[model samples]
Target chain A: GAGVSQSPSNKVTEKGKDVELRCDPISGHTALYWYRQSLGQGLEFLIYFQGNSAPDKSGLPSDRFSAERTGGSVSTLTIQRTQQEDSAVYLCASSPAGDTEAFFGQGTRLTVV
Target chain B: AQSVTQPDIHITVSEGASLELRCNYSYGATPYLFWYVQSPGQGLQLLLKYFSGDTLVQGIKGFEAEFKRSQSSFNLRKPSVHWSDAAEYFCAVERGATLGRLYFGRGTQLTVWP
Candidate 1:
């Protein structure tokens, strides 16, 4: 794709239900990142991936939050148990390398009801 | 610890007026600075970035920002504001050693009134 792509632009789920958000990064990009944007909280770094491996998961909010990337192309973020506080916009970005400027996606807005 | 700070939560300006958005960051060394704009129901767009070289950097949509090392600030400025420029602006910083991790400040929402 010409730019980073995220699936299911918006999702509304009941509390305690699990949800999966997908991200497709730009082709040939070696670095991928996930961020969460909430009202007043600003953009929070969630994870960073180099190739197919996630080198930095320090930003994951909890154990329920897990992400994986395969073939260095597509990635998935799964929230095991959703909570009301989990409602936010999830953003994905890709860069040619770790230190370079990243291109961002439209993001998936997750709403936990 | 590295962090970005945007003190103004909301700002309003009349159309065609000059605008300035303040940002400050805390980092041990000089870091990569960036300004991004997010319109309602739209994704974030890069406004400008300061890596090295000249402190003043020009960005899209007639926006410019100056990077000051002493103050640890990167402020965005525009000579003339437009109605369409009303949006949420964010300031972000990346560490020199850290890769792919961008620390962002609480956004500043700008409202342009005619």
Candidate 2:
């Protein structure tokens, strides 16, 4: 892909339903990151995957939220039993091996009703 | 714990006026600094970054930022503001020792008045 690609530009679901967000990073990029952006708020880091191992999962908001990356190319972020607070734009970014600047995707706007 | 702070919530400036947005970060050691801009309903785009070099760094869209270690600040500046520059600006920092985790500030909204 020319740049990072995210699926489901917008998602609306019931409060208790689960949702899966996908991200296809730029080819050969070694670092992928997930972030959440609430209304009028800055991005909050969720998880970072370097290769297959996520050395830093400290940013995950809760146990209900989990993410995994396979083949170091695509990543999926799953939110189990979504809540109103989970209604936000889920963003994904990827950077080259050196980790200088990151390229971001359009993001999935999640709405919990 | 590493965090970024952007004190001003909203700022309004006339077009062609000078603009400056402040950012502060807390980290044990010198960290990688970055500035990103987000337009309404758009994804974030990198403006500039500072790892280790001259304190001042230039970025796309005529944006620039300076990393100040003593005051723990990395402020974005534009010589002359434009109406199109109206957007939300964010400050981010990566703890150097740590690999890919980036801490971001609350953000500042810039409003340009014509």
Candidate 3:
């Protein structure tokens, strides 16, 4: 079976620029999650979608960060006006169901200068 | 509020020796506990999870975890650790029935010596 895949393995951008990261979840998965991992820090929850419905967005650090999952398969996380503080590895994961074991993607390393 | 705690930020263990990684969690109600391992430049891999029933659960890579409700702990253990086991381990807790949003700990960086 195909695992979760993420695009733009590495991205370097200037501050105040906008960047979009893509995630393709496993086939038939109904749950998708996005998290940020800063160096020497734990995984910080960003947004999660269960069948295209995001019931939890509280983990999103600010309004500049937003994510959406459409057709219950793919998800996109967009950062508007990125800041140096936003530089980190963005990871995506998906599970068969909302509360089951999750499979992860390699992650996109976003660097803001 | 729900939270996960990994007491040791780093631990060094000798190869073929016993190992244990402590995890404590704070949750209002019954909690879902999980342990994940991440190698450098890789995503997190689920080591094990404890939802309900048996307090002891087995996981991949010869790992196991015991859930102690009284102490609010779910500790991971591996009797004989291998050098390849060196990596960052994260302890997570979830609010029951809420997709277990997974509150992660700061993580424990394990170092294996030969």
Q: Which candidate comes out best when scored by DockQ?
A: 1
Error of 1 at B27 (Å): 1.1
lDDT: worst 10-residue window of model 1 chain B: B93-102
DockQ of each two-chain model: 0.72, 0.69, 0.63
Off by over 4 Å in 2: none
lDDT of each: 0.92, 0.91, 0.90
Question: Which digits, one per residue and each the tens of the lDDT, describe model 1 over residues B1-114?
Answer: 778999999999999999999999998898999999999877778899989999999999999999999999999999999999999999999885557578999999999999
Overall local distance difference test of candidate 3 = 0.90
**lDDT (tens digit, per residue) of candidate 1 on A19-86:** 99999998999899999999857799999999999879999999999999999889999998899999
Poorly placed runs, candidate 1 (over 4 Å)? none
Better of 2 and 3 by DockQ: 2
Candidate 2 global TM-score: 0.95
Off by over 4 Å in 3: none
**Isolated chain B TM-score per model:** 0.97, 0.95, 0.96
Looking at model 3 chain A, report the run of 10 residues with the lowest lDDT sum. Answer: A95-104
Docking class of 3: medium
Clashes of 3: 0
